[model samples]
Target: MRLNFSIKTKIILMNMGILIPIIIFIYVTITNNLYSNVIKSNIDLLTKESYNTQVYISNYIEKDKGVDIETNFVHKAPLINTYLSKKLNYRIQIYDKNGDIMTDSVANRVTLFDKDITNAIKGNKAYVVKKIDGNIYILFSSPIYLKDATLGCVRYIYTLDIEEKFINNMFIIMGILAFMSILISWLLSKLLSEKIVGPIKKLKTVSQKVTKGEYDNRIKIRSGDEIEDLAETFNVMSESIKDYVESLKEERQKQKKFLDNVTHEFKTPLTAIIGYSEIIPKLKKQSDIDESLVFVKEEGIRLLKLVEELLDLSKLGKSEFKIDRKKNNLKEIIEEVLIIINPRLKKYEIEIIKDLCDIEVLIDKDKIKQVILNVLDNAIKYSECTNINIKLQIENEKVILNIIDDGIGIAKENISRLFEPTYRVNNLNSINNNGNGLGLCICKEIMKKQNGDIKIKSNLQEGTSIEIIFEGN
Candidate 1:
């Protein structure tokens, strides 16, 4: 079973676990030892005093041959006890050999030291510790011997009130000290726990802020420990997250720009198709009517192509839009494209110089053909080039197809944005041209999906070169 205790709780529990037992053990040990030593020392003192009194009685009995031992003890007991009480501070008692109490300084009080009395009757010295009426005492008993016979026994009763009171006062002081120790331990433990847990808490707060979309928030801790290292790691993670968020924002803005461009591009072709179709029936002269119908047909075809490109782009975004990969001839693909655009090239007085390599490459044949067609079309549209050079070569384990043209080249500024969706170069010479600009964007997307890429390099008034790079066979 796992107990999810907070750091502070765990710290306090652990500290107390160690400290409380130690404090109690020390207090009990010291108190017990002191009490035991005091009792032991007091018993020793009483034993010696009782022995001296017994000797005095023995000598007194020997000197007076006719005196009654009990009567003599009775007479001398008051003075002896008075002197002992004043000098040594203990009560004295005398017991006869038969265990009869002859004298008790406590004034006929019942004896609680029966075990001590029994031992004294056996002619053996004995002592016992006893508590009576909430007060402690030690009773020491010693036998009196006269000529190989037990005459009487001496009993000493010492009150332990002052010793006990002293021990209790010491106990109170120890308890107070223990409490102070616990307080200090608790304060230090808390301070240390906070120091250790502080950085983690800051990290949690900052991480939550980042979770709530505050990517800029970070923890700054300077404890110079593992937690500081953790904080530094957290800060790095925050920076990475911030960078990722920034990239996402830029991508979103680009997508917005693409959508706006799409709107404009679609609008232009639809408008042209609509306008030309509306004007065709109103023309009377045969030449004017033919011209208008031709324009209408051209715009209609352009619109259809634009729609197909948009559909293809959308399908490629889905998981199910897979292409047929087969071994295809690059030479044949180029020849086919050239044949398709042969008439248009001838009409523009453009000559194509093809240096084709007959290499079999694994590719989506149709998609690659589309890319070539788009690039060639762009070259024909914007450039008044009389010559276009096409070359396919294997280099550095890759197939590179280069198309060079001497045409109205793209400006340096427009080269970067050329392959973006619906982004067209604004040609000052031909602003009236109806180019939707989705062609190159579609080509680029198709190449990317096929694990290939397209790159264009252009110089204004000089020429443009388009390189299509693909994995070599």
Candidate 2:
């Protein structure tokens, strides 16, 4: 079976694996050196004390002249035992130069059966020994000379169980310390790994969200380090991508609107041209030449207007139409629009009510004129009422113009899309008579260029109000 581990777990394990060996190695090195030094010091102290005790006993025995060695040492055995017992925490023994144990702290007298006694008799200073009974001890011996004649030797024995116990205890403590150190190291590794990997996991999740097209998703990490910097960069990148996508969407919308408007405008003019051209020859026998010429001129003019609007819309779509702005009287501009549309207004029986305000605004004069003409023309074509009210007012440092009429009003559903090119309102009477749907769209664009906006309010069979706002100078 394959092993599966999360990234966090794997990081923890890897860190532990690297750090545990180093910790263990360091602990072992330190503990081994410390324990070795302690044990060696204790052993050396015990050996030195045993050697000194043997030397002291031999010198005292040799000091007596013409005395039986056994009797003299036997009498002093109690004093030696008292001294050795207080100084060394172990059983001590004394042996003669002939390898015969003379006195023992644990026994009155003893025979030299241990190898330590045999070795001591051969003038060994100090040596460690292990008896058959598994007792470990250190023995030291020294010779006693009486006027160049070897009389006897003295031996001392010290048990080593205390040192053994000390070493065993140290081992146990080291084992416990090692285990605790490993545990603490593991825990610390886990914590540090989590701190490092937690943000990475969040980043992974955010990346997946972005991959799924959720460009607005962001990662929040404030580590004050490289990880935090990485998250900040990711957020910036996501925002940039989102902005680019929105810009692309807007461009596509503009392109679609431009194509639809151009198609609609061309279709009407082309149809009129073909229809009039087809009817011209047939009507020649019944119509005067001048009337036919006028009909042709009207169609030609209509086609020319369509071409002009299409070209203007295309230039605007390219973002190449620069506005030539100057301070101008908005009232004078409206008056000029009214004069231009006078023939249409009279023909359509549309009444004009102008509520002009003296407001000067910075705008492109020709562009503002086109905006006014398009909106008023649309109103005159759709309004069933004879009176069309044009209101101008200044408020909040802005010039506001409202063109209202009792027109075949726009439906509620179409009101929102009124400024969308080629999106005509679904009223046949208005659609049949109104200008191309691009009128409102063009007005909206022109108003936007002038640092202004256009808005509409309408209900079916009521009136439609078109409002324009311009920046006041």
TM-score of each: 0.40, 0.38
lDDT tens per residue, model 1, 11-87: 78899899999999999899889988998898777777767766766776667668766566556655655655566
- After superposition on all C-alphas, the RMSD of every candidate to the true structure, in Å, is 38.0, 39.8
Residues 172-197, model 2: lDDT tens digits: 88678767876887788777776778
Which window of 10 residues has the lowest lDDT sum in candidate 1? 428-437
Please give the distance, in angstroms, between residue 302's alpha carbon in candidate 2 and its true position after superposition.
13
**Residue 449, candidate 1: how far off, in angstroms?**
85
